[model samples]
Target: MSQDPGLWTVLLAMIAGAIRVSTPFLFVSLGECLTEKSGRINLGLEGTLIFGAMSAYATAYTTGSPWLGVLVAGFAGLSLGVLHGLLCNLPRINDVAVGIALMLFGTGLAFFFGKPFIQPAAPRLPGIPLGDWTGNPAIASALDINPLFFVGAGLALVMAWGFKTTRWGLIVRMVGDSAAAARAMGYSLGQVRLICTALGGFLSGIGGSFLSLSYPGSWNEGLSSGQGLIAVALVIFARWNPLRCFVAALLFGGAGALGPALQSIGISQGYYLFNAAPYILTLLIMIASVSPKRSLKDAPSELSITR
Candidate 1:
């Protein structure tokens, strides 16, 4: 019946870490979900995520307002999304190629503009102490939830609802499932996709805000850690469902937290392996989720055609 304080502490750290780390994944995966639902793949989101991180950090440093930084990040994401959409519309242009190019472009731009703000202090996002009632410092620390986390959660609900009940969602679904059907119904395929891509990028930009303003709380050249690309795989693992994306984000977050949680308890033997847990888990999930039938059952027809 003896209680192991170290185990409890590690658990608390992981719980808190999961909540903190999952925010960006939630936002980016949701954004990618929307983009793919519109039958377009935006690999450029990796670049957008980095750009948003730099933009948010720099804006917060300059303006002394984290919220303003968040807003600007969203605008940056929108701009990038629009650019991707526009470029993809050109005849014979591939979205994946455009996305890779944009990824480099956005990262380069962020690094160029972000150099000066690297060491500057930026405003931090507010957090709600949900663990205050627990009377345990570890628990309290773990439960300090960011407002943006709630925002992303709310967005997931709205997205799920919209996909099931809203007209706009219907239009997006139609465009994704059948470009021919959409065209027959007078919907412009390019326009619908452009709007979805922009909106998706906007959300992704918000995800970037969470990274620089909340967790690591700094502007740096190597901030993103490939979260955007991972989100693409995350969307696939979630089977294109918004709610599933939310849950999957948390799962990935927990995996990411495993390393530090172990290290806190002095488990240094496999530190790198623990750090790599998230990527390994992502790979496993992708492997498990792949259909042996050679058909992504829930994938949009337009996306298949584009690929």
Candidate 2:
């Protein structure tokens, strides 16, 4: 066996892994944030994420353009989101139940169609060589960042600013906070939710594209590993703030990197256990953040969980 790396190497690897692993979380959380802010919850994002991955990989393999794959994935997600929105808009429909059914439906579709592409090679998204100047191979490799990471970060900033300043942002907030008020103000509640949910699905799809086209760089049924579902909890932990969602994503990414970082330094005995860190952290965060007495102050009044 090869010798173990030094402490510095482990830390550097963890940092790199955090940046890499967090991209999907960031995108998914942002998507969920947008959806919930519009007074709707989408548990179906798990299906959307996996289906997006399959579609992106298949499209990239066929078209020989990873960017096109990304675009297609977003549309795939939008289609599912639209379905969800339309179903939920029906009289007396429950958003949560509809979302769950869609999640299973989406996953089934991805699994059925994705089997063919599992063994084929697909073009992957290119990364920025940020560490080229470092003069160290390992450091350089670690710093080779993906462009989508930057895009996600920029999106978070835009969302944060838009929520407090833009007209669309105010409308979403109004619709989410009080449906009756939104109706009184001449806004259509169903329309706002449908639009936001579709947009959220688009973002989630892009995040899935990153998974298949950038990091793992492959098509597989198990690619998502529940990141889509976990993002819902992440949104709650973030208090629905886009800026805080970004930070929360990074934190979860760091937790996820812990196992691999240790393994890189020859600590592989409990590797699988270490990999469970993210889920454990999620549980802890939810426990600490949730309360039975008082509701979250920043939670939308019309949100189902909050009620």
Which one is best on lDDT?
2
Best by TM-score: 2
Query: How far does residue 277 in candidate 1 sit from its true spot (Å)?
Result: 0.8
Steric clashes per prediction: 0, 0
TM-score (all chains, Cα) for each model? 0.96, 0.97
Residue 41 of candidate 2: its Cα lDDT? 91
Off by over 4 Å in 2: 1-5, 293-295
**Whole-model lDDT per candidate:** 0.89, 0.92
Clash pairs, candidate 1, are none
Which stretches of model 1 miss by more than 4 angstroms? 1-3, 290-295, 304-307
